[model samples]
Target chain A: MRHNLVLRVVAKLLIPFILLFALYVQFHGDFGPGGGFQAGVIIAAAIIFYGLIYGLDAARKAMPDRVVETMVACGVLIYAGVGLAGLFLGGNYLDYFVLDHDPAHGQHRGIFWVEVGVAVTVSGVMLKIFYMFASRGRDPE
Target chain B: MALTVIVLTRSRNLFTVVVLAGVYSFLMATALVALDAVDVAMTEASVGAGISTVLLLGALYLCKSEETKPVRKPWLPLAVSAAAGALLVFGTLGLPAFSDPAAPIHTHVVPRYLNDVLRETGVPNVVTAVLASYRGYDTLGETTVVFTAGIGVIALLRRRRKQPGAANKQDAAK
Candidate 1:
């Protein structure tokens, strides 16, 4: 794969845009056909493409296992924290109505954070799984 | 699409089967787009067709690439599957027409979400609004489910530490 110049160049050219598009889907989910889950998978796909083009070492460096592991736990924390915040703010569990001074604004804020949580966990889990699978059943480098 | 499925069923090489399964998923995504379920389509494209292929391929690397033929004829399993599929086709007859506005589901709490989402959530995408705000608990549960799945995979597949040259110290699976 490293010797394949065409695939290497094409993947290098396409990876950034794939990431940018994932971000667009993540942040603009409120007005678009994509959201956290789709964006997360796309993000993982870009990294996996990079891994294929260069090597597993390069991709692991780009996204370390520690970060991926942290992301997996942190996303759930962020989501649950939002619910806890709602409870603290005198709203029901997982309530977005009281997240901000204006209920509408609060809804937007809550949704934004929740979607972010979803994205993080999804991408993290994906990368972690990919890494786990790729590292096994082969010679150690 | 049916052709892809047929080929998928007939394929003996596991790699070919995995790739054909991805094609089937892509076709399903296209069908979802035609049905105006763009969000689900995007999910199907990315998760179903994209990552699923890679993951399955990775799993395939762990074992033989060729599927061994069954020793005996599986007539009972085939009959059961055919009967189940027929029941599913028959069940579809009870379902409402595509995008039927007056369907019971549409007439239920959907109206509140459709009518009040923008005003309350300030989100234009109904799916996002519903998933994130209207049904926040469900999304939280789903996120936790993803978390649990990740943990489960790590628990099952993670290897212990070995000598220096055997693994990356930072990203060490072994």
Candidate 2:
């Protein structure tokens, strides 16, 4: 794979667009056929593609293991935090209607943040699984 | 697609099985699209076809490419599976007909979501509105599940690299 110039070049050209498309799916979920889960998997697929072509070291360098671990926790925090915010705002748990002054606006804001949290957690989970499996039976550098 | 499934089951090569499983996922995704479930189709394509294939391939790297034959026949498992399939088919007889306006789901829950989703959530996608707003707790729980799974994998796989001389340090890291 290291000697395959065409593979390397094509991956280099494709990775960025794949990431961009993931972001698009993440944001456009409310209007389209995608959301956090799908977008997260797509993003993970892109990162995994990079790992497949360039090696696990490069992928790990791009996203450090410690940071990935933190991401896995942080996403759940964000989601629960949003629910706590709703409770504090004089509504039931995860009540998005009370998130902002205008109920509709609050709903939009809440959904957006929740979806973002989901996206982060999903991508983190996928990457963590990939890393664990990929590193198995490998000789440490 | 059925042919692919048959080939997948018959193939002894793990690599071929993984590849054929990916093909099955693509076929399922296409079927989802044909059924007008685009969101589900997208998820199936990305998670099932794209990521799972890569993950399975990574796992394959650590294992033999060929599957070992079982010592005993699989007649019991096959019979159980057939019984479960028959039970499921029988259960479907009690279900409301497809696309029936009077169905419980269509009559009770879906109408509220479809009618008030845009008004309340200010989002055009009812699915998103329902998932993120109406079912926020469920989504939160799902996120937590993902987090838990990640933690579980890390716990299971993240062995401390034993130093060449300090073999005792592995327990300390754990």
Candidate 3:
């Protein structure tokens, strides 16, 4: 019971800030100590906190297994698809210079998409691991 | 530090042991950050304090919490661990200093990324540029790790279904 309350209050307080900070890291990584990977873990940690407090079922209700699975696949797909796009644009694999006429712009576009992919995959993995561990016993409630 | 280690060693509670281990990890992470390895420090902080703690707690749930009294000296394992630690520190002495301008790590391909990645990639974040573009293949592997973990979770948590005849019989009785 105490765990539940702690989880609830912590989740409510931290999830929003975690998400906001993720965006900040995503955008301001060059100037700070964080990047997509760190932000992704932070977001996932928040969700995992929710799972620990509310039980696996409630957590699943909040973030369905299907959605998490799709996000995992989609992240990889998005990353590969961007590289393939560069291929179509007549460049080498992951060659962002050909993404647009302006090579610099292409690089920015490529990095943005890839970071999005990282964020998706990392968060999905964290939540999935939490779900696996949390669902391990018979109904204890 | 030695005193804390003695206290932790003397404690006979597994919960206290795990908590102390976490504190130790946090201290190690602090040292890493102070040494200017922010990326490694961040990874350690998340994996050590966040995920490992949760996993350890789960394992603790399925086990007796009390620590059994020591029956034998763990001298061999202690000696091996100490030797490994000494070897690691010794190895580092031969390596370049952190952020050294002339270090091979700083002078090689890394300089290219630091100097030109922003200008070439038009991305304000050079780390993102390197992670997403210059080293995309590595990122792909990282993503696959996540994909495998998700699948593993589903496999582990999937519920077993009752046999059709059993379910039908139960329904008829109801």
Best by DockQ: 2
lDDT of model 2, residue A56:
93
DockQ of 1: 0.87
TM-score for each predicted model, relative to the true structure: 0.94, 0.94, 0.83
**Regions of model 3 farther than 4 Å from truth:** A2-10, B1-12, B68-72, B97-100, B156-159, B162-174
Ranking by lDDT: 1, 2, 3
**Tens-digit lDDT track of model 1 for B98-164:** 7899999999999999898889889999999999888888988998999999999999988866766
lDDT of 2 by residue, B34-108 (tens): 988999999998888898899899889988998999999999999999999999999999999987889988988
Chain A alone, TM-score for each of the models?
0.96, 0.96, 0.86
Report model 2's TM-score to 2 decimal places: 0.94
- Best first by TM-score, ranked: 2, 1, 3
Could you arrange the candidates by DockQ from highest to lowest?
2, 1, 3
Superposed by TM-score, candidate 3 places the C-alpha of residue B95 at a distance from the truth, in angstroms, of 2.7
Weakest 10 consecutive residues of candidate 1 chain B by summed lDDT: B165-174
Stretches > 4 Å off in candidate 2: B162-174
Using TM-score as the yardstick, the better of models 1 and 2 is 2
lDDT of 3: 0.77
